[model samples]
Target: MAGFLLWLLLLVFCWPLALLALVLYPIVWLLLLPLRLVGITVSAVFAFLGALLMLPARMLRGRPV
Candidate 1:
């Protein structure tokens, strides 16, 4: 993979920072995981509500809602 090669090159060129990233990436991902989940949940809830509110009009139009 190009991405792997890029990181491998970075590791070869700058081991300290690359290693730091390797160590910290998961920590950052874990820290942000809850926020990502909450965002997805909120978006889903809003989408469901919107579809529910639209259903009556869609039915009136005979649109096969």
Candidate 2:
């Protein structure tokens, strides 16, 4: 696509910047890893609580108490 071609041209012309970003990307990801972990933990806890709240209703349906 045109976007890919443009990106390729940019990479060719700006390789040093690209390389710098490549080296720093992982470090930045590592620095933000704890935030990602906290988000995941919060999402999992909410899902668990929802499932627990739904359990009684599921059992009352008599489908498989």
Candidate 3:
């Protein structure tokens, strides 16, 4: 029950773009997937690096940590 509610909230908040993804899935898979995959991978790598850089600031604040 609690897990389901948590998962629902997570899905709602994290996947707000899911509907758009669903609509675009076929088109993306058929046409854009290969082209976009490289960009996606690069973007993910940059985002990860950005998050890693921010981790020190977050930890130093001692807020959540």
Candidate 4:
């Protein structure tokens, strides 16, 4: 019984720490998520556009565009 109560008390105290970590995850992700998304989008857009712009030149060279 004493061991059971100690286990229960440990859980009661530890649960909040776990809960706080869970709650903070979204906030941390939200803060950094946009920068990651925007970086990917910008890089992709630029790479695609660069490829398009270079395609004609590549074709003129009789190489794979």
Q: Which candidate is the best by lDDT?
A: 1
User: Would you estimate the TM-scores of all the predictions?
Assistant: 0.87, 0.73, 0.44, 0.53
Task: List candidate 4 stretches off by more than 4 Å.
Answer: 1-26, 63-65
Tens digit of lDDT per residue, candidate 2, span 1-65?
99667657767999887777768879999999999999999999999999999998988898753
Model 1 worst lDDT run, 10 consecutive residues? 56-65
Over 1-65, each residue of candidate 4 has an lDDT whose tens digit, in order, gives 99667656755889775667667879999999999999999999999999999998888899655
Q: Give the C-alpha lDDT of model 4.
A: 0.84
Instruction: List candidate 3 segments past 4 Å from native.
Output: 1-32, 63-65
TM-score of 1: 0.87
Model 3 per-residue lDDT at 44: 99
Shift of residue 60 alpha carbon in model 2, Å: 0.3
Ranking by lDDT: 1, 2, 4, 3
- The TM-score ranking, best first, is 1, 2, 4, 3
Q: What is the lDDT of residue 28 in candidate 1?
A: 100
Q: Is candidate 1 or candidate 2 better by lDDT?
A: 1
Q: How displaced is residue 41 in candidate 4, in Å?
A: 0.4
